[model samples]
Target chain A: MRAEPQSFDRVLSSMCTEPHPAAREAAERFLATNPGDPGTYPTVADLEDDAVSLLGEIAGLDEPAGYVASGGTEANVQAVRIARERAENGRPTVVLPESAHFSFQKAADLLDVELRVVPTTDDGRADLEAVRACVNEDTAAVVGVAGSTEYGRVDPIPELGEIADSVDALLHVDAAWGGFVLPFTDYEWHFGHAPVDTMAIDPHKMGQAAVPAGGLLARSSDLLDELAVETPYLESTSQATLTGTRSGAGVASAVAAIEELWPDGYRDQYVRSQNNAKWLASKLESRGYDVVEPALPLVAASVPTPLFEALRDEGWRLSRTGDGELRVVCMPHVTRDGLESFVADVDRLETRVGLEVAGASE
Target chain B: MRAEPQSFDRVLSSMCTEPHPAAREAAERFLATNPGDPGTYPTVADLEDDAVSLLGEIAGLDEPAGYVASGGTEANVQAVRIARERAENGRPTVVLPESAHFSFQKAADLLDVELRVVPTTDDGRADLEAVRACVNEDTAAVVGVAGSTEYGRVDPIPELGEIADSVDALLHVDAAWGGFVLPFTDYEWHFGHAPVDTMAIDPHKMGQAAVPAGGLLARSSDLLDELAVETPYLESTSQATLTGTRSGAGVASAVAAIEELWPDGYRDQYVRSQNNAKWLASKLESRGYDVVEPALPLVAASVPTPLFEALRDEGWRLSRTGDGELRVVCMPHVTRDGLESFVADVDRLETRVGLEVAGASE
Candidate 1:
């Protein structure tokens, strides 16, 4: 038998929330349309164009040339491919901070580009000095994370952009998790940074769109055109995307979600989500957990692995950082009551451990 | 405003029918689930595994190592990546017929693999003599198409397999549009042909699953393992896929669609669709259009560009061959009445064009 629809109320580590009702309806509305082969259905092509333009606006680009990819991985891979193609040097390399997502490694492996990993600072942000030392004439792109996957800390993109300019390398900001929220916040993570050339943003993550709604935005259409390959068989003259025959439902849902959340709805949700993360961090700190103050809506706390496993066993969905830190992402679906109940469980576990220690000491 | 749900009843150029109702329900049922990062929801992962296994069975594999990809592009790309990695040569090259899907070109661009395109025969089948001449010690893979996208012709996969074996090169069959039908047909396009190492099959094309449901099947688990990259930040230990954070809806929908169509449903639909294509081909030929007899459900015919454009302008969706042949794909949603009405319109256009020509001659 197939599984039932999962309840989103208890999900803590996920950047994705339950899709907005409008988004789900939009997906259902276009479930049969394949946007990749658009000649069969021109209406879907129009919706995809509108969706891409709207996402470009959200990323702070006036006229972005990009498409909604399968997810951040495909988007980032495409960004790296563009950088590789545009690089003047024979040996192409990409410089990324240690805090960058693993998709860069995947891209490096797939595209035969050299990947230079620079260490991040103690605060979990990309270290600018380290980046400068790593970048060279052969560097095709410099990658910065808008929201680091584990810690949810936005890298200093403005400084990274300046560093990229010195090397004449494209700056690709991976704003997959924070793209929807950072736009409404006072963060310098978008294309407003002068040297930013491309970005991978996912509406499915924080825009509350249905899944598989990731966009890759480029500052110039010329950069995107460099990746196009001739398709002699299809209606479209050329195809530049990483995937063939992509679903139109993702594009339609993203457009619907953005339309419903634009101007104020997203800002309101961001404020609430940020507040929830702040509240949860304080509660965990008070209970003796060494919490990392969230820059976005994700809070990472130093917790015992046994206790982490115990919490997971207790039906609470959570994730752990690479260094074994427990993380909780405050999405719109995660309610205050749910966090409180999780805190209550942590308190009980603490009490049980304390009693066991006391008995062993006696 | 968003485009309204398209009426698929009149769509003739698409191999995709309106998604099976069960497929749509399954997608909606798993809209909130993310199988890519499955630590939070294990059930969706199970569904994905089951879906992959079922698709492998359809591809004539008792035990296959694979995953559900975003579409044929990702699956074919993954197959090429596998071949490149496994090849013992320093310079890897893939040999494919000119009629292969455009995704191979995209893969060649992304993976830096030299793609050698051998010209097809007049009947739209891969030329065995040309393929034999192309294969060498440096050839990493030889690709054959189960169903040519433009002409709906099945390449001689059994002969292609023999050629690949002679060179010790991996043989990959791109059955994206034919996998669901060829098993029921007496076509030897699957793993039963021993030298076939990998296959890219799309459920969305002929399985009637919702969009974005494609699978990549490999003969051995070791081949699939070669693509795995360590993802330190996500729930999954290693990431082999082209995309991260993929939606579970595709997997669930595929599984549900397969379950609903298994045993006899697909075979019944296949017979009906094949009959429809044959009937359409006969009608087009009787009307003096040079029709290519379809091996699958696609019917390609030589129509004047003016008539083709007029048909499109009149809201009849269609695709064309690279050499400018008008094509009609008879999918499940296409009815007898729809084809009859389309033929009537074609007859009318022919008379109008004939009158214009006579008047010009006068």
Candidate 2:
């Protein structure tokens, strides 16, 4: 019922809270066994390899090729940086869908590159025509969104890959939200299948992991060469991340999360989340609400404006996207019963939005 | 024995294996909460005001001024970015002690600023004269190391402040390893009396909090104007940090750690760490090991090159500095007996390095 932090303190605290246990344990363990960096006890290298093995299991990547990063934003930013560095230098431009995450924009801004947005179809899929048109000799990379921030839709990755190949540009998939989920979903074959040159995954999201925890996995080892900054204290090996001194706790937690889920457990969890989402969508539509269907477990509904405020007053939290559509991200924790309660609450508030759903529904 | 992970895997399973019950409970409580873009449901404003009120019972700031970051590296980076942004366009350079944390160099490199290193005195503290010689009109910021990474030496902050004032540059203190310790030690007054404009504090390091946790406290709220970035999804508030999508779990854990560790509790922790450090230093010194003295909870020792390798062969882990000095960072969990064993092992390895006691003949 209270207001959120509009300032820096609120944002920072929020970020820190997600990985508290993992980070705390990491710090305590590091202090307990290897109190100082001066010692040769379980070095960060051992931790790195351990994390890589665990992540490899989760993503189903064969060679354990990847690096840890602070967050999805940094991972995305690093991918952009790598692409720019590999650019021919005369012109550098990154092509991304209009529905791509804001981090793509941030990365382009940080690297001082031009950002070209490709239009998306009405169903929230990438417009392949627009994407092909956007690519040229100056194109450094093409970013396709898996689970876009606006519509929670997965772009046609294989089609985009072909487009990128035609232009001789890198294909980066901003899979921050859906990277771990796709591995367990019906679309398991879609991931890393279409020659996604680089992908960013956040364990904190549907991976059900901690925060400040995300990674970028590249198919080619050469991708990391662009970000390699050799230094005395922080050295870059074949495997390197965007920033140094990352929360080992985050990495450890991610490793643990993946180990717990392994192969079958995680796949089952995604199925449950998807089922829950489908059920919620069906119930909402039956109640006469305009629900976006075949949704990627993310439901964006359009109801009368007044009813939205009524639901908020009833203690239900829903986010509105840029086009004034309310969105609900079906997290792993969102339960079936909880969905029912949410639907019922919406039904009650429907009258306020000038809807007569009980008898005149659908 | 198999190495334990940095901490319990909070993502995979909602389980707790931490030794401290309070910390474990705090972690669980934090995981249950989530913040939205404005960050998690309770909102960061509410959490910050709550944390400020809770910690205010300890060393409460007069005004609500400060930003939370992920550990000392990020805190230092953010502070450096602030200084650089506020500097005259053509004159953006940072000067710090040679003994400062490698993170400073990283921050400068990432921000694309010139870094000038000032030599340290024999006492391991920053040389004020060297600092003055290095600073000129082009210098954007002067960084003072409190509990430097290599030698764990505290710079003369007050004296360094004078040099920064002369150069008309901002003075930033990297107190990541010692911030929590200083507040409760004999140096309590030093922090309040120092002329530092900004400081990086790591709750995870000396505060014994979780990892990926840190704070950047500046003397004035006006200093934060530089780290601002404007985007459609994220609005840069007065206290925004480096990245977005912060995890609320981390913030709650830090707040809990700070609130739980009252002044007296922190004082006890500091005393214990310092005692362990003193005992180790004294034992090493008696063995005629080339040891740096007057170090806080962190002590550095130099062994003959061969002896260092011999100790590594024996499975003792230690950190080496740029100059090949091995460091020991005593913490909450280190025991007196363990310190004695470490010293004895080092003494044995000294013979392997072909270094005999100077007064062996006597």
Candidate 3:
């Protein structure tokens, strides 16, 4: 019946982390405000605009158009809805990589769009040839991933954009986790790098904002106009948001987090997280386990299931890929010492079980 | 970029109010946790279960199946989606009253369903005969408004349920603003009163929880299973929520608020709010304005546009019904003193404008 929170010490697999101090304070201050009714809560509503602009700065759009969404799911769904709304073809279809998040499946079912899930390359990136083969006149959108969920892999976004252009379809980049860190890396993603018509980014993931601080940015305001619905009773005449009467806490905390940690703070944090991921990957590799390279502060290793479960029993929050690789996300809350302790637990479990070297096969 | 909130002093038209003290503290304590990932944050996830159970007690559902939503719009949209999924007919249609919130319009558009909006009776309730006539085999759902937005009027829900039964459609009650107070009233509009299949009730509205505390409940768990989608990476195999990675703050606050003020506190608050509404209506009527009877702590007066604008100009945050009647809602924050101040502003605006008795036309 009580909802007290535990510390984020063992939360290695979850994408969410402890919120930045400024985000927590800002969210508390605006807990009562409703951003959906912009006229009544002008400050929080204006903060939403500011959050979008900040996301644009991170996503490489000088003149961005978006709103703070409930989360990555809502943002992803809205992007598909926009593509479906603006498509000129009959029975709108969407082509995405196999590495795309499961939210696209939800979007396809809700919007009644044909989803063409193409295969990924051996390196875990989307295969451009398969994407090209799948896209046609009916394609409403082509999706590229900046950071895959199971493994950190960025797709060939510029090529995907080219394919989308060939079919007169929009290219949507799902940078929900990579957006804050990709700005520091030399990744060819986001609006500034290519013709990405839409993007989904989350402030709560790497920007250290509170939960529900997800962003959906567009190349122009016209793209958002396709999602607009008339709201007769609010201060604004029309609303493009998927949900009505949203909490302003997310909007305010998004701006607060961005203002407090834009380029410099996020740059340092990304460096630290990337270093932790590299350390963990090296540790696992030294133990004769095949480790996926740290693409963007995420590590996946082929650990045996018994050993993985044993480590989990030691109070580590962990998850696995569909392909049975143990996944660890080096979020802002994850530290080098935490990974060392995790490795220690794995070593102890291996010594106790006298396990076979199945990880070497990967 | 500053998101400092203004006080809710002049706000009389909004359904939301300032959070209760316990709710605010609980929200702050659990700001970063995600109830969507129940495996990672079990405490907050369990709190969501508790919140749904509390809402069931209030909605008269013995065994409720529901989850905390982002807001009422998401809950309402999900209700329509469930009906569409469970329906055996092709090209789903929905029958709703003109008094339904605009979220249904957004839902119909998103779900590719035809919306048949019927007229309302003179007392502002949905016309039962019109609703009965609109039901057909293609109708996926029938919507009844327990408390309408413009004028708080409860529909003939039992009759509407019967009409929906004839077509094998689900009946959804939108009690987003009425659930917290309806228990104190004699309205037969809940699951115990009728065969209500699904309901959209928000804790953020009159329950005095923070924003984003919307609830969606069903009579049985089978109804919610219709909206379930597979989640590959999480501990839970499936999720029925509209948005993923939601802030646990909403669920925690909803439980805290309901625990702090369920029967005793909300009943007293409703009595005071209803009394204030009656007093305001009498005062406006004495000044030659045609006021709608205080049906459920909401008042609508046929005030002249100029006078309404004048009152707004005098720093009274107000809105009007579609028919140009000044609308005011008695939220938890609205008090008799606040109503006195609003009336004083109305009197001064009338005197300054030297307006004629235009409201007497009604």
Candidates' chain A TM-scores: 0.96, 0.83, 0.96
* Clash list (residue pairs), candidate 1: none
Error of 2 at A18 (Å): 10
Error of 3 at A43 (Å): 0.7
Per DockQ, the best of the predicted structures is: 1
Native-to-model Cα distance after best TM-score fit, residue A315 in candidate 1, in Å: 1.5
- CAPRI class of candidate 1: medium
Individual DockQ of the candidates? 0.74, 0.18, 0.73
B1-362 in candidate 1: lDDT tens per residue?
Answer: 44786688667778677878998899888887888887887888889889878987888788888988888888899999999998998779999999998889899999989999999999899999999998999999999999888887888998999999998899999998888888778778999755789999988888888888888999989889989999774667887788888877888888999999974988998898899899999999998889899889889999998788888878888888888998888777887889889999999988887788788999
Q: Per the 3 Å backbone cut-off, how many clashing residue pairs does candidate 1 have?
A: 0
> Can you write out model 1's per-residue Cα lDDT over A11-81, one digit (the tens) per residue?
78787778899999998888888888788777888888998899888888888889988888888999999
Candidate 3 CAPRI level:
medium
Worst 10 residues of 2 chain B by lDDT: B8-17
Between candidates 1 and 2, the lDDT winner: 1
Which number leads on lDDT? Answer: 3
DockQ rank, highest first? 1, 3, 2
Q: Estimate the overall C-alpha local distance difference test score of candidate 2.
A: 0.63
Q: For candidate 2, what is the DockQ-based docking class?
A: incorrect
Ranking by lDDT: 3, 1, 2
